[model samples]
Target: MSEVIWWKRGVIYQIYPRSYQDSNGDGIGDLNGIASRLDYLAGLGVDAIWISPFYPSPMADFGYDISDYCDVDPIFGTLQDFDRLVERAHGLGLKVILDFVPNHSSDQHPWFRESRSSRSNPKRDWYIWRDPAPDGGLPNNWVSNFGGSAWEFDASTGQYYYHAFLKEQPDLNWRNPEVREAMHEALRFWMRYGVDGFRVDVMWHLMKDEAFRDDPPNPGYREGWPDVQRVLQVNSADRPEVHEVVRGLRRVLDEFPDRVLIGEIYLPIERLVTYYGEDLSGAHLPFNFQLINAQWNAPTLASLIAEYEAALPPGGWPNWVLGNHDQKRIAARVGEEQARVAGMLLLTLRGTPTMYYGDELGIGAVTIPPDAVQDPWEKNEPGLGFNRDPQRTPMQWCPGEQAGFSSTKPWLPLSDHFREANVETLSKDPRSILSLYRALIAFRVQRPALRLGDLRLLPCGERVLAYERRLGDDRITVALNLSSEGQVVELSSRESHRVILSTYLDRQTEVATATVTLRPNEGIIIAA
Candidate 1:
């Protein structure tokens, strides 16, 4: 078989700029800090790095509220610094995927300022603004993702602007040709650097209902749930017109070769697959977050993976996301033992795998102090279980104060387990989480079947999730015991096999039978 695209064949490591590393002893992380860790990341065996938004912002929603689309924020670093980091990343044979936020811009943005200056401004149409309803209320019943009404009343302009998130992030009018053109140009600005591609932020929110209609109530919504779920969201997000916008973005992305477009879309498998476009022309990969919400069990995970595999469009490629910046870490959700199993499952699966920063070290969420809380979701709702600060803590680099992430106090607190669970400490231990990740990544690189193969589920008991990856004659079977009790798994191929690697890292025995026993919570990969 011929070689496939880099993204399709290797793992993508996500770096949250503010928490990755700090070079100048400032409490906040900077661009130079990220540049300083290139060697460490390269050693981690990731094919590419996807950095979250580091653009100029007002700190309302962290960097998600972009004030400038063309430049990096000073807290992170200068454009030249970013350029240098990209150069270094490429030199180390690593690709860079920047976070492109298109749904909204910071309220302080020049376009937004001018758009809100007056109703007759030339750029007024760049953002979505509407007259109050007949009773001088919000134009519609849409709700914001961060908890209030989606429309913010502007006392100065006597008009209301729409914001899917914080009011500071005014939604752009994608229906406006000029807005689309400007956003496309933003994509071009990054492309000029010959970077890999973009991970478009809130891809599903790019388009909204054209008629300014009210969203119906959701049957699934409970009175105490987040207000965003109170409505069906039919008119607020995931509109059919989003496909056209994705196609338009795809056209610009296709102008450059081997550059991928990964849309940050959160939808069911059926709707999620459509982002691949009718001809797979939309996003190169629409991040599959099924695992994030799936129950951590053998039968449940097996069904989720198979369902996602079967839902892909004709030429669509699959990608798996175990953890991300928005949600809790894999270790925090599924336990440390299972995080190792998750690493194995993610790497050996049929699609691309993205590892959240510090996940390889089994980093879980840290408790944020009430006074140190920064997430707007937490601030807005207070106790609605919407805070994201716990997952955005500083990385544990070494066994030192501040975890060697910064010389000064970090912007957010570090986990108490930093001393015990850090790169410097784990790199020396054979059975460490970091070691297992490196081994799994290296093994996947050398074995073509594991990287690119067809998946076949094996017959197993309730406690085991088993499957085989086959690429011609080279076939490898994987059996994972999700429960604490041991279980016997029956393999379809009754051939002689050798254990390539195990979670325990000490079980490399040979097998020549159709059935095998997995020790409690153990996962193994066997080659025949």
Candidate 2:
């Protein structure tokens, strides 16, 4: 195994810092809080931690709207605090990956402030700005991901600026050479600070169509869907020029050794694969969210996996994500019972797996009260269920006050079952979802086949998804039952295999016959 293949074979744990832990008791998680918990993460067996943005910001987008590219947000802590956290993480053998929000900057950022000051400002072209239509309407029909027009009219400059998300986050112009150099310099700054890698945010939105054409109407638009969904986003995002920008970012990472670049792209498999760049020089991992978006049924997931595997560019590595801060918890999307199955699926897949902070404990989304809603999306588009607060609530560490996430009340409500579903409570139970996650991660680490093997889909019943991972003589077969009822899967080989781990966490060392019986919402890993 290559020493630098840690990213390829290791699990990446994502930390939404504000909800992870609060050391100062300010009801918000900070860098010191995360550093204090490094041992806990090391015990969980993830090889790396990908923390969400903690850059200096106005908090309009909860740290995603970066104001200062090189400084830590006061709410998160100072530069020294981040350095200590990275040092502690490295000491524990954990890689540190920071969120790189290169597509846009907080409207309050100095760059944007200067760019919007006047049409002839030196930084005027740093962001996407255009004159209004002949009738003084929006620059184009582009819609913001949050809501309404993507173009935010600037009264002072008599021009409109584009923001794919909140107006507070003005989109940067990657088309500008100076803008690209600045973002690249920001990346290099972090890289020099001992950061292992970066999870680039809205990477596909870095470049827009130069023609400024209006996006076509979405044929599948529905009334209750987000306003942004009304358009196909053809001209506004995922433009062909984005690949060159991605390659440029890759070149910056190449300046540092053993550093990975993972792009958060929401495009389809075909378009997503393109971000890998020619000869796979773009993102080391263009996050494969098919598992997050696909139907949980066995056939749907089976086909989706096959399609994604086939769509990868030559030598392009694959990665999987079941849940994230922006989406509903995996346990909430699928029932609690199936969350274990999901964990097994995520850890056993044939590539790097990114685990959301609280999913290992089978933590589901909390119900956020109207008064407690913090997500800008939910506030901007009320009653449309665009709320992410439910999923972005504080992590349930224990059953104590604030679920041990903070001494004070958490910024958002905790799940009703936090008392029963927290790590302190679940870690003691061998059959708990948390235990299953640990065992699966350990099993993956110990087995080369599970980590770097070629995958082959196995023949199985409609309700059972089965596959084999083989690297030389090390062979492991994974069978998952996706339904409420039990499932029976037949192995191609009649040789007896030892069950290494199961979602139920009760089948280790058990010998499985050629025919395997999987309990409801159960998945198993067997070694030959």
Candidate 3:
């Protein structure tokens, strides 16, 4: 057997807990609901699930504003319910990875409360607090990711508390050793509960510039973009100290067996790989969101894959994510038919693929009304059209009431295509996107060429992307047509090839000749 780690050879499924499935008619998904869906996830052949935050929170930024890192939110479940979730998920052979938000904690958290209580408090330095600038304005030009200034002035404390996100979520002082130890203890707490790993939220934003330097303007920023793009976050994000932080986190995670540390970073590929740290001591996989932001064209995606593959440090594993809770749905970003092609590219590429929950069904973003906007960013800037609620609706389990996600109305409205775009409805159709995903995942898992292989992008022209994944004697060739118009590519290989899986699920013709024909928006994996 190969010495590749399980995470290196497996795919991870992201489950946004609040919208995954609601069991108790509370209009919100809880731990029991997630537990109930274990078999469904297992049947999909995913090796692990990275659940978004379900910790006790004030819901200022939904679950991202964590009030208690150790306990489960009452709306989600209790500590016992979380225990049951981990146990059940592990029993089903699915590793459970929790979302670890070490960057910031809710202002309601006991640590922040004590830190902000009085300047003389024992934990006063646990969170970042600074005095006003010379003009008595704000500290500096640091921008909050949500919008507006990064500092929130506290009248009682006579200093400004920093928050990279919403004001309710204060930035934790990673510079302090005591704060680092406390956060490390949180990791230990979850590890003791049998959790497999963590997907650290905003891993690049852990350490900010100590001098509080003003962020410079983005020269390339265009009109009609989100306001947060107005300034380049030079001093606010992706500081060099974060790798040291990652090393410490890796040390804590090293105590466990077969565990993984995945970081959520949106940096350039060159800077992103450094999180792997010297000697691979940082994150095992700093999520590559390049696939998410890349244009849906062969040339664009081909260059992105090549650049990312070249950027990885020696012994550093690669991972891919097409969509996540914070971004637009892949189906909506690309078209519905092309989502399958995107899925193929995500899985067939030489990396561990993290599939967002509802993408397997080609689910599009639901329309969110002005009054029902849930994202704090949307509320902060209503004119920017940056609301994330449309992509966070409840999971469509069946065709029944509330799409069988809940007995009562769900917290968010169900998608309009819930009837046809559900697990039950698609389970019966062999050509459905869910079926395609199952087939692709099963095939990808069983093939060493797909799992533990070297990636080599072939020169197949601009409209077609062809790559080979070769492992010793085993080899798999993949061809993806980026356009709606049918195209053809010539493979250099003279050996015969058989179709393993196709995006359209009908192209099974063997490709023994140099020229290979393709259907519009088709993606196929061929056994070489």
TM-score for all predictions? 0.98, 0.99, 0.98
Candidate 3 residue 494 C-alpha distance from true site, Å: 3.3
Q: Model 1 — TM-score against the truth?
A: 0.98
- What C-alpha lDDT do the candidate models reach, one value each? 0.90, 0.91, 0.90
State candidate 2's TM-score: 0.99
Identify the runs in model 3 with alpha carbons over 4 angstroms from their true place.
1-3, 509-512
lDDT of 3 by residue, 1-528 (tens): 347777999899999999998989989998899999999999999999999999989999888989888989999888899899888888988899999999999999999999989999999999999999879989988888888888999999899999999999999999999999999999999999998999999999999998888889999888878767889887888898888999999999999998899999989999999999999999999999998888888888899899999999998889999999888999999899889999998898888899999999889978887767778898888877788887788999998999999999888888999999999999999999999999999988788888889999998888898899999999888999988989887766676777767888876665556677788889888875
Clash counts per candidate, in order, are 0, 0, 0
- What order do you get sorting by lDDT, best first? 2, 1, 3
Ordered list by TM-score, greatest first: 2, 1, 3
In candidate 3, clashing pairs total: 0
Point to the candidate with the largest lDDT: 2
- Give candidate 2's root-mean-square deviation (CA, Å): 1.0
lDDT-best of 1 and 2: 2
Which residue pairs come into collision in candidate 1?
none
In candidate 1, what are the lDDT values of residues 60-134, reduced to their tens digit?
Answer: 888999999999899999999999999999999999999999999999999999999999999999999999999
